[model samples]
Target: MNKKTKFITIGIIAIFSFTSLFIFSFIFFPNLQTSINSSNDNGRTLQEEVSNITIIIDYSGVKDNEIYSNITLINFNTTVYHAILNCSEIKVQDYG
Candidate 1:
């Protein structure tokens, strides 16, 4: 065969090999496709829920420490600042 024909044959073989391997992997391991699609199982989305929260506030110069317990929060936009604000036992100070 000519050099050009040999190169084309090799390219076709390489592509076919890769395609076959890709198809066989899905056929043999079905879960591989699920994992590739998403990290969650059975195509279910992850949910974020926070409850029974507790916070301990201890200052370096102060002797009396504060403990905030049983603070249930049910907001999707709960952040560190929001969680601190949700607790009424502690006082919030805004410097800005």
Candidate 2:
């Protein structure tokens, strides 16, 4: 094929591929704004309803190469739930 014809073919293919990807993402993800609006219609979010939430990290007592953290969720000045998080065998590196 000639140079002009080859360049036109490649440009058409690139445009078609980009348009197809854009259409696919919209069809699969749908609309997020509508979902957020529907949730707000029900009531306030969990954080707004809760009075206080505390997260404690105990790095002084690192055992077995693991760091521990405790999460306390309080509602109306009462402890409602507690969660313990353990990070074992995970190394954090600075990539600066």
Q: Pick by lDDT: which candidate is best?
A: 1
Structure candidate 2, residue pairs in collision: none
lDDT, residue 68, model 1: 89
Would you estimate the TM-scores of all the predictions?
0.39, 0.38
Model 2 regions more than 4 Å off: 27-38, 41-73, 76-96
> What is the alpha-carbon RMSD of candidate 2 to the true structure?
9.3
Q: lDDT tens digits, residues 1-96, model 1? A: 999999999999999999999888877776654453376667654336577788877776677777888876664645556668776455668999
lDDT of 2 by residue, 1-96 (tens): 999999999999999999988887787666734644466875435552332344444567574333333433344333233233222234557999
For candidate 2, give the lDDT of residue 29: 68
Report, for all candidates in order, the number of backbone clashes: 0, 0
Cα misplacement distance, residue 5 of candidate 1 (Å): 49
Cα lDDT, all candidates: 0.72, 0.53
